[model samples]
Target: MPHSHQNRIQAPQLAAVVVACIALFTDMLVYGILIPLLPLMPAVSRSGPAATGLLFAAYAGMMIIVTPLAGRFVDRRGPRGPLLAALLGLGMACLLFAVGGPYWLLLVSRLLQGAAAGLGWVASLALIAAAIPLPKRGTYLGIAMSMVSLGTLAGPPLAGWLAREYGHAAPFVFATVVLLIDGALRIAFVRPVPPQADDPATALDVLRVKGAWPVVILIAVGSGVTSMIEPILPVQLHEALGLDSVQIGLLFGLLVIVAATLNPLVGAALGRCSPRFLVFCGVLLAMAGLLLLGGGARHAPVIAGVVILGAAIAFLVAPASTLIGVVGARTSPPALGGAYSLYNLAYAAGLV
Candidate 1:
């Protein structure tokens, strides 16, 4: 009877984890799907590099503004409502991208996508924390993070291939289908999990937790440094190595593949190791990789640098997220949503 009872309890938790992972995966997949196609946009092609940069910036900028507000909403309400809204927003964004139009439409699509990303990430992470037990949260979060990396790894190449064979609209069409499926899953499987009874912490209150600032800083710096690579690396690879779009996609995919493979190990380590220590090591690794990349005019060196940086990101992301979740639960359980919001906001700021 006890075993059966335990199984019943575990079932909902498992379902919640699955739903959260899918939501995050869908969000990242759509984000990455656009990377290869961005340059091909009519406006971008005509306007040159500056326009491309602006489109990317628009997404990150919106995320920075909306994330904290989304977090507060999640804390006050629950993850279910915010998550559903995010999914709807993502669908709209994908539709706009598929329709393809004036430069303004592209910008609007990106902005909406950014808002969805901000809300989706915070709500999904908060839901995971609510569903899973603290001791096991790191492992599950790691798995979910891996889904994110995998989405990034798969998206560009898949989109590139689809665009090459079918048309520009193909990837967006597929994304819309995937989003619909994700919405159906959420509607069916996700339930409203209430916040803890403790008073909800304001953004300021959440940031006041001991050890929060350092992690927030690390999140920002790590995100900022890595964000620099996406825009710069493709151009560099094209100019220096004469790589085509497919090759560039492959290279970017390889980096995320390494990160996806290592994230679970890093997640497992969170249970046993000091989160701060892991973060410090990750920073050193990223620095080393950056130094190596500076010397990477050649292929071998570039691949090595990318692999090292991928591992570094894996180390930083999972541990930092686990630490934040643990800290929120301890300091003010109802504030977990706000805490994740701040973390993501820092990440967006880094991109800006």
Candidate 2:
């Protein structure tokens, strides 16, 4: 290929990666921002914690349904339209969250956000696969996952400070502004690559690939174990160790910090090692961490478990998608979108 042609290809791929990272960041940021604000909101507070839990469930539930459909849509229509639509939906959801009327309105906002999440994730991952070469997929996916981890780490503290100093609506407004800028950037620079004609494998065909089912199972089990910890850990700390809210917060923060710090390293490793080996090691580490958590009545053991579990999560998460992408690439007819959709679906189901 000519130098100019190479530049053209690389430019779009780079833009696609950037767009995917930003989209994933925005999705996680909005999600994390809601954690603190929901309990404090007047409409939500009156309904109690169960309602708030339901709100979270609503998002995951929609994601479980929408992701596979979004993947199929991307396969048929390319990612640009669904990506743009998701951004638009996310913007609207943010606007609704900021406005804050009835409790039902909040539910509506969450539902929209879930749809956006589903579309955004499916489109973004599919776009990444389409844009980047197979060997580099893990590295770029790691970068994208790192952005998500950072968002999760940053969003709650930022939301709490904003809500404390400003008002309940302030964080959502901030999110709205950031999302608008992100959407504008997408519109301006992120052009979609056409779906490859060679990738004719349907979702069912993708599922039949030898290694794919095991990868999906691993994703689900890993995600389920990780998700279980997030809600249960603070309670365990408060009751078992008599830690105050601030201490609990710091501990959770440490977990995210460890995971975020290690994400890029794990991602880089995925490029060099067999993903299956990394995943197997990760599962073993996770089991050990869980054992520690179960037995650790004291502080040191608990902290050790937390650190080990965080590392396990990083190992599991960074490689699972890469492995799926790799398998899809090797298929008789590559089914990148379908393979990714199943992975996303499994992860979302695990979260719920």
TM-score of candidate 1 relative to the true fold: 0.84
Judged by lDDT, which candidate is best?
1
Q: Which 10 consecutive residues of model 2 have the lowest summed lDDT? A: 1-10
The pairs that clash in candidate 1 are none
Q: How well is each residue in 173-233 modelled by candidate 2, as lDDT tens digits? A: 9999989988887788667577655555655677788888877877787677766665455
Candidate 1: C-alpha lDDT: 0.79
- Give a tens-digit lDDT track for model 1, residues 1-352: 8655543438888998899999999998998888767766676666767777778888899888777787778777878998999999999999999877677888899899999998898789878877865546556866777787778888888887888788889999999999989999899988988764443564566688898887777678767767767656766666687766666677778778877777778979988898878888898989988887777788888888988998898888767666766556656544664566677777888777
What lDDT does each candidate get? 0.79, 0.77
**Structural similarity to truth (TM-score) of each candidate:** 0.84, 0.79
The residue-level lDDT of candidate 1 at 57 comes to 82
